[model samples]
Target: MELISSAERNRLFESFKQDAFHLELRDDYSVPDEESPFTSWTRGESVDYSFMESWTQLIRSATSEGKTVRRVRVITEPHTPYIQWEHETTGINDEAGEDIRWLPRHRLPEGITFPMQGNDWWLYDDKLLAVGHFDDEGRVLGSEVITAPDVVAECVRVRDLLWGLAIPHGEYQP
Candidate 1:
């Protein structure tokens, strides 16, 4: 249960050699930086994406080094505004070399199970799991890094199962 800062997580992204897989289960994220953009998007105003430069660059660098960067977002249909915003802005991630996929929560396969963490996580090279922690308001607190074999195996299993059922960003309408 070692909590890590964003900079430390970025270091993991920069160092992973094989693959980086993110599982996003939350329907809304109350990130302070996204408040303005989300408001603008809801108002039908053009939203600025400059804030994503650093992340996009990191993904690009990872993919350029022959590592795969991918994510599977489990969203509810008739999405929350935040999820819609994320879906709309996914192109930035795609252009930056990430493979994004969507899975409607209801479409989840029967009998599927999640790890005990039951939170969003970034699994690096199928070995390290950086589990995201959020406050009740959906604000990110920090990530906990776990390397235990059983936990890591569970996360890997969840990632693969959901990833296989998710629709590619380009193909998913919502």
Candidate 2:
């Protein structure tokens, strides 16, 4: 409902979840995605680690006021070495150790397909990109959507590259 500013984006990152505020970067700068999946396919803008932490903090804050959080969907090029590098660097993929959740594009229902990938078309869910902002016992609060187009593009493009790398259902890639 409200568009957050760069300053606010920064603050949220520093004082919040280490991965709280993420931004999107695109591989194809010439094309700005009109069908931003923030509305359809995936959730939240990609952010630097600082912003990511702040996002986590904001979710906790909402819960302090009585809310619950359960899921967050991140769209990324499943093949990006950066994905693994970041998780490995930030310790976000520690299984029973950290808070990061990795969902390859193929895992979600109808999440991946052809023509879409070959033409560099990939869609993600914005609804899924949010935290619960729940109650102490896990009830429900509101939602947080990352609407910044730049961040969205970054995420989408990165995921596109990864899609290229991903071993498809029929072992397809073109």
Candidate 3:
């Protein structure tokens, strides 16, 4: 399990031939960069989105190239503070050309299972898998790159199933 750096991940995104899909199963993410912004949002203070400009640009460039970028987040209802913050700000990703969807955890279809220990992942072109590793507190540790056929196959199954059941961000109130 080789851990891929952020730069490598960006390169993969730039080089993907068709589509990039992400599956987020966690309800709370403890990204350090989001701490201050999350705190401000909790306080009802105006939050700055300038920090996301680069990422948004990346997505915009990808979509403009006719490559698709999509993600589905599985969240618990009555949302956690982090989930609430994510829900409130998903427009940033949408405006950048990414398709985002929300699925309530309880609504997942019965007997369906996820691959890669149920961790979050970015599947590029249905070939490469970048599985996210998080610390006990939910902070990012690093992403592990996997290229095994069986594993990628299972992830594809998970993506297809959950994506079909997820609601578009605009219609999801959570």
Candidate 4:
């Protein structure tokens, strides 16, 4: 199980030919880069969004090329503070041309199971996956790249199913 840093995983965007889809299963993400801004947001202070520039820029470039970037967040009802912060900031992602949706955990299809041990994953062109791993503190460790056809197929199936049930960010209220 080789792990690649998030930066390296992001590089997959440079070569993916069509769509990149992300399945987010966590209610809280203790991302170091987001700590300061998230803290400010939690404190009811203005958050400078400059920290997101690199990522948004990447999304913009990809979408401008006619490539699609999408995400489905599987969340819990009565959102966590981190999720609320994410919801508030998601418009920036939308503005950059990514399509993000929200699906409450309770809404998941009955008997449905997540592959890759329920880790969050980014699937590129429905062929490769970057499965996220986390530390005990819930901080991102890195992502493991997986290309087994069987695994990718399972993730693709899950993506299609969940995407259909998720509400677009613009339409979702908490």
Candidate 5:
């Protein structure tokens, strides 16, 4: 399957008419751009977050146009260092107009199964999906664009369920 670069995937935001939803299923991600910042954070050192400006800008621009951006992160309790950091920093995303929620894995509905073989995905306007693929070391490889109705439908269903169940960023503690 052909994959698109993250930049290309982000471009989808420009054309999508309404909403963009992201489902995050990982406890840790090894994004290259975040390596130094994450290392610094882990070391208890103050670190610059300029690396996140580009993404926040994207969300800001899109949401300013009245488009909705949302995310539901499924995580385990006793968060990993990466997740702890992500939790601490989620306010930035929220401030940019992205509605982010957290759902502990244990709280997932019984018998529910994720589509796209359980990988993370971004759903745009409930019609298109950009499924994230990661290398063995957990670095993102890019995304595979899928417009198949069945797949998108299942994702929409999952999104609806999880979104309803997740706790909004400000309300969740740890």
Candidate 6:
């Protein structure tokens, strides 16, 4: 696959705004060192704060106008509250009719990381944000990436369920 430049990536970012829903895949959703500055930090994780701010504002508008946006995260533990906020703030519907599935990281055969291993992906829709790990199996392992649409559907289903279980930030814990 041909690599796209930062400018092209930015354009992809812009496309997210135009679409009613969007998806993203990242190593982790939150900015690293969120707990404390004292924590060790990664090398050169430059982020787009301004762009993220703009996106937040769009969320505000969307919520006020009652347009739903789904934010999904496929993580091992401590799922972010922003996901709940994103759902409640977006005023998403409870019964969004999406599928849900979970396959553990350990389930992933050993020896996989970002570049060498396939990266996970996120899918956002009017009612859900779905995340899936990407991978290519070694001759002795499972497939590298999720190429099947049925598995994708299951991931979406899982997102819908978790979204329902998640409560609005600070108000109540579901």
lDDT (Cα) of model 4: 0.96
Give each model's whole-structure lDDT.
0.90, 0.34, 0.90, 0.96, 0.96, 0.35
70, model 2: CA deviation in Å? 7.8
lDDT of 6 at 57: 57
**Candidate with better lDDT, 2 vs 4:** 4
Task: List where candidate 6 sits over 4 angstroms from the true fold.
Answer: 1-52, 61-66, 72-121, 126-148, 172-174
- What does the lDDT come to for candidate 3? 0.90
What are the runs in model 5 whose C-alpha is more than 4 Å off? none
| Per-residue accuracy of model 3 over 1-174 as CA lDDT, tens digit each | 668766677778888989999999998988777889899999999998787888899999999999999999999998999899899899999999999999998899887678888899999988999999988888887899988999999899889989999999999986
The TM-score of candidate 5 is 0.99
Error of 4 at 10 (Å): 0.6
Model 1, span 44-124: residue lDDT tens: 999888889989999989999899999999999999988988998999999999999999989999977778557899999
What is residue 14's positional error in candidate 5, in angstroms? Answer: 0.7
lDDT by residue (41-149, candidate 4, tens digit) is 9999999999999999999999999999999999999999999999999999999999999999999999999998899999999899999999999999999999999
Q: Which ten residues in a row have the lowest lDDT in candidate 6?
A: 137-146
Q: Which whole-number lDDT from 0 to 100 does residue 64 have in model 2?
A: 54
Model 2's alpha-carbon lDDT is 0.34
Alpha carbon deviation, residue 143, candidate 4 (Å): 0.7
lDDT of 5 by residue, 84-106 (tens): 99999999999999999999999
Q: Tell me, what's the RMSD of every candidate?
A: 1.0, 15.5, 1.0, 0.5, 0.6, 10.6
Off by over 4 Å in 2: 1-3, 10-78, 92-98, 111-174
Q: What's the alpha carbon RMSD for model 2?
A: 15.5
User: Which residue window of length 10 is worst by lDDT in model 4?
Assistant: 109-118
| Candidate 5: Cα lDDT at 65 | 98
